[model samples]
Target: MSNDRVLNICFHGVGEPQRELEPGEDVYWVTADRFAAILDEVSTWPVPVRLSFDDGNASDVEIGLPALVERGLTAEFFLLAGRLDTPGSVDSAGVAKLRSAGMPIGSHGMAHRSWRGLSAAETTAEFDTARTVLAEAAGAPITTAACPLGRYDRRVLSALRDRGYTRIYTSDRRPARSGAWLQPRYSVRHHDTPASMRSGVLAPAPLPARARALAVGTVKRWR
Candidate 1:
């Protein structure tokens, strides 16, 4: 495995959500059993893997943390600034627990909306205020973010770059260069099995599919 590349696997809520889910959000939640199994499978992979969890879901602290600890793995937990301490979500104390457990934190913005089109104020709220709030909770500076809903355009990317974001994570389902500013990740879905994950994520994507991914990324960067 080369140190120049990595496979970023992102996870969302696991087990039963404590709060009402957003419309179509259920697709991202995987069962605890399946989550563990997938982790076991990924453990055997030879390449370097970067694990991340989005949303400030309580399950992150309740289930996700313990599982990672058991496997001797650490993940970056991107939390929603607005959703922190809300019902069904991870609270400030939960963030503390994750930090104490040696997990790094990143911002998922104030609201869990798409980051494609926005007014200046919305940008400030999402990019500025959210980072401040999340940093306060984490007791550290937040210099990284994952695009909410996996949505971002050229303008959005520029805004993040302007703010000095070290790296941005996207749901592009592809391999990523280790030190790239923009990192593509494969999101775990509700129905995914360990075998399915291996075939879908760990395996090299076919030539046509890789071309499509490259084209899509180019468009997103330039659009």
Candidate 2:
């Protein structure tokens, strides 16, 4: 990694799911052992890495936080405002606990739905109201956001900017510019191991792959 670029590694649910998961969401869940192994591996990287946990799973506070704390690492947690206090989800106490532990809080929107082509009301709920609710939960202002379901387009990006978010995260699977307002992240999946993660993330993408990734991000921004 260069001084200008940093890899953003994001984790979803860790350990067993306490409640029902959204369709296809299970693929993102990694076992407790796997999570620990990957975290241990990533913490040793010579390059810069930014860690974040998305979706507000109860395991975030239960498994994610302790493991991170044990390693003396800190990460940002992006929570779903609508799911707060629900069974199997991170509750109010968990949010406060994470904050107390010195983890930054961000919003993953009100509901875990695609941020593309949303109705006006849906947009308000996801972008505007969600931040308000999540900020209240965090007991601090929420200025960063991640697009729900890794989906976003021109409208989505514009709305987020209009709302004055300082950092906007996306699952674009590419290393991000360190100071860019829009950050792309590589999401860890159930099948991802340290070796695979190293190849997929630390190793540079081929020319064609890099071009494709760039094109995809560009299209997403303008569409």
Candidate 3:
């Protein structure tokens, strides 16, 4: 990887779900063993890798945190403010614990709804109030976010920018620019293995594939 490039790896639930999952959400949940192997593989990468956990699943604290700690790695945990304290999700105490363990806390919005074309009120609740709720639980300012369900459009991006989020993460499945405000991430899924991750993420993309990825991101931003 080039010095200016960085790989963003995102995880969702690890192991079994404690609560009911949304439709099609099971694809993002990986087994504990798979999660561990992937972490170990990424730790040996020759390039810069930024790690993050999304959806605020309880496993993030129960399983994910320990694996990361054991590997002497830290990640950003994006908490869903509305889901805090809900069964099967990370609660307020879990959020605090993640922060205390040196993991940065970020807002994953109030609910795990798509941030595509929200109304005015919905936008305020998801973008503004969600950050407030998460910051209070984390006991720190929340200045970053990962789009729910990897969905976003021009309006959504504009709202996040106007809110002054220092970094915005998306499941765009491409490498990211080191200092860019909008970061694209490859989310680990149930079928992904260490080798698949290495070949898919660690290996450099072909020039045509790279161009296609960039075009996709550009379309999402402006469409």
Off by over 4 Å in 3: 205-223
Of 2 and 3, the candidate ahead on lDDT is 2
User: What count of clashes does model 3 give?
Assistant: 0
Worst 10 residues of 3 by lDDT: 214-223
lDDT of each: 0.91, 0.91, 0.90
Kindly report which residue stretches of model 2 are placed more than 4 angstroms away from their true locations once superposed.
Answer: 205-223
Task: Report clashes for each candidate as comma-separated counts.
Answer: 0, 0, 0
TM-score (all chains, Cα) for each model: 0.90, 0.90, 0.90
Model 2 residue 81 CA deviation (Å) reads 0.4
Q: In angstroms, how far off is 95's CA in candidate 3?
A: 1.0
Q: Write down the TM-score for model 1.
A: 0.90
TM-score of 3: 0.90
Writing each residue's lDDT as its tens digit, candidate 3 over 2-67 gives: 558889999999998999889999999999999999999888765679999999999999999889
